[model samples]
Target: MIPTNRQITPETPLDSLTLDELDQLLSEKLVTLQVDLLKTYEQQLREHEETLDHLHRHRRAISLPPRPTIGQDDWHSYVYDTRPSREIASVTDLVTINFTNVHTVVDIFPVALDNIHAIYKLDSGNGYILQDDTMHLLTVRNQWTKSPTGCSCPGQASDTRCACCALGSVLCQVSASGVSNTCVEDSQINSHTCSSQSPRSLELDNAIAFEYHTYSEGVQQVVVIAKGENIHFYRLDKWGLQDFHSLKGHNTINLDSPVTHLGYGEMFVEQFGTVTRKRYLFTFGLDSSSKRYYEIVTNPQDFSIETGLSMMWDTTGTSMKVWQNGGRVIIGVQDGTNLNIHELTSDRWGRQQISLQQVLSLPAGVTSWRSYATGFENFLIATTLPLPALYLTVATIDRFLQTQRNIPRNKLQLVGVTAMFIASKYEEMYCPEIGDFAYITDKAYSKAEIRKMEVTMLNELGFNVSYPLPFHFLRRNSKAGSVDASQHTLAKYLMELCLPEYSMCHYKSSIIAASALCLSLKLLDGNNWSDTLTYYSRYTEEQLLPVMCKMASVVVKSSSAKQQAVRQKYKASKLMKISEIPQLKSKLINTLAEKSASYA
Candidate 1:
């Protein structure tokens, strides 16, 4: 919170300020605060989007090389083909994890998937409080996973008292020790008891745990029980479960309270116009609805919730979490087969309005999933707990390898990881420790090796990483083509298809991108390459035809090619499943390739 020139001069007398002057001063400060808020908000938003885009492209070496296809069925007939140079890893994805009968896997706040403490469902309402692979008799929650249990809690809760542990009629009160543990913990299961108020039957759709900092009561743990439109708030202190008045606003200096967090209320008393202010905090979250129902609670005091000003919004969402106290909202919305995730910030001006800041898309189901928030901050610690950390890794490796005429095979793995380390520093939002990067190699390289290599690589490359990438040019050319979502994605797939081919490296990136898009438009039965594309791309149809031929040739061999990473990636529904489109196989492409090749 930097002091601004707008601050009323401390040297000025208080009597000189009038009510109108005070109001004017307050408005200006607020406007300035909001502008600063918006700038910071936009910056974080851009980093998040770039991180996703960075991950979306190549995902670095995070994904295991396509299942190793060289062994097993083809081992007997497989003959090693000698080439000038080849990959350190097999391109074909051979390793796969197979499961049967399970419809949905629910794990809570997992550190990792394979080794997580969770309660999973094996369809038909049969629940397993412990993960099948983890194999533990104990569970964090006391839900009878075996036969028909007394509770048919459909949803899993974050920590100890999950909705799954709740019998359609009772709220489970967990001990404060389980407070920090969201999904499961290795600790003993806490005793569960229903609220003493009788009939004790209330079905729960979702249960969330959050921390609240009160004006008087330092830091308190809070739990929210959301079922349909009805919400219940409970406080979890050392004294155990106590009812909180409806859900008053939580105090946070983070993204939650935008203005005051920046001290907008502290107008100068002497030099600045004097302003007395009463605090009015607001909170908004999904109230409940298949059609996306939400509610905004306005003017709640620090201690108690005010009932009169709750406003509901007509929208759809599956789940939501308030982060930075109440500054921003993270929501999960179901869009067809995919679950769309979004981040929102409250509108600085409006009492009930919130702005959408970020978006994410995930596949229908995953064996293991990790929920992220607070920890996604722009800290220096690498969580590989996984960005430009994608292309930066590529640029580093390409530069290092291209410069070194001869490098040892054993050191190649070290070089690869070292490049990733350098890239993460340059491009990644949150970079892990140098030791953490070393661990990713299964101890093949020591921390000292990675740290030493990092220095060597940076010095050898002269710290230059501004290598132009195909994705960059592809974006401009796609805009020039004025293509639709499918056409643009198909173009991306075509461009990526040529990435593995050694020969394609000879052409300029801009030409390669232009050619891929040009072929995509023609293949889709869309318009021909126009003057705009030629002008922006600086590649005429005849010149592009040659590169376009190479791209088409890569596509023809893509399905059968050893490098299946590009094909497997674009085949997902998220990327519009462009690789599976039929135009890649058409004779028209063969004709174009032959025609282009004939020129040389």
Candidate 2:
């Protein structure tokens, strides 16, 4: 409803007031009430202005790259000189290991080179590797519980996770040496073993490629044979021994497509049809560079792989893929030139296709780095990781928002919260609710205080929530036909790859901004050369391109000096040279474009 600029008298009743009259009264009351709101917002604006001013004032002195990466010393000191066996310790081994399927925990393993004996997928969303050295399952949870067999032989026993609490099942390990799939049940101390119908098959060279399966709420058990290119399902349930399904084999020597192996959990396996019999089967393929998703309609009577929908990604020069979020499916359709998102709804045959027009609705820009993680409240969150420098900038802005007046607390919280969400994308599967943030805040902030801050922040920032800056560069730089012929090449490259929505700048300026931002962050905080390059390497460098990486470092340092000079010489004019900022943004875009065009 539109508000009126009229005054109201005290005689107006609460319900008797007309819509117009109510609006007028509400407007008047708002003016009166907002005296505090205005002041708060104004204070916040001033703080934001001051921070910008301070940053400008000290811009020359500010360092480009942060020094001393986190955990540098600890990382270097923890040397792995000996090769540890990757075999899972037997049930008789006296040790316990924490197990989980969480992705964040994947990077926390102290021993990377050590062989993983068994990979355990828990009902809880986390994956863990069985280790022989410590004999303890390590997880991101930071704690481990001893299995019944290993309870007495624990090396570190701060806390033990009760076996009963576990889902009470382990992935059947099949090796050439032939090991039994028996493990102690959570409720029962005795071991329950599943026999191997075929004496251990070492058909596959890579153990990591092997997958585990079990169905029937444990009534029917099925072990998936992931050896070779084709998948073969073996029924391990009381159905005795029988080959439930065997995929048409493909000889690796006659490779046809870039075959990628994707993982599925219990829920996905359940969706494969029903507990009683097999339900659905499908495979995904890519056309040179574009991603195509295909689903096969399976008939339990006679298993068949049906040819489902085939889709061609709209944009050129992109690395595209699909990911499932909780119940919903998310398709990552990178144009290689621009970023696009499409929601897929399947037909009766499971044929799914997305329209080009609908692709326009997503958050614009070529994504630099994106990941889905499970949030605290089981909500799924897609996040973008920030460079260290950008994080510092955000920190500075947050500080300003907190202390400034005229800004609502919610406003400031919005910025920090959104950034937090973006950063979490590369790590977690989900993002927590806004209320979750509020709940956590109680440990440090009061509700009223937060509300006040939010209001002030919204007012100060002019309520701008769009941060398509990264995408802008991606689109321009990543376009399929883009060429690196001008200063704007980098920007074009960014637009091509990132597909960032346009804001107020040219494609070139956008490229400069994104590249500078990323470069600055890496300089300030990245540990190794590879970590520093990250997305930038897609366009600017090759696999482990040390020389290109070094060039990026030089580019950032040179640009920092140039920007500093501009700040000093022009002082008032913020004009700066384009060369100072690294051109990774452009390079990435052009690279994707070339890649796309090649396929086209």
How many angstroms is residue 503 displaced in model 2 relative to the true structure, after the best TM-score fit?
25
Tens-digit per-residue lDDT, 63-167, candidate 2:
544423221111111000011011111112224344342322212111112243343432232334444443233221100111222221123243232221124
Q: CA lDDT of each candidate? A: 0.47, 0.33
In Å, residue 493's CA in model 2 sits off its true spot by: 14
Task: Give the top-scoring candidate (TM-score).
Answer: 1
**Once model 1 is optimally superposed onto the true structure by TM-score, how far is the C-alpha of residue 372 displaced, in angstroms?**
10
TM-score for every candidate vs. truth?
A: 0.38, 0.27
Clashes of 2: 106
Candidate 2, position 506, lDDT: 31
User: What's the residue-level lDDT of 397 in candidate 2?
Assistant: 51
Model 1 C-alpha lDDT per residue in residues 573-592, reported as the tens digit of each score: 65787878778789987776
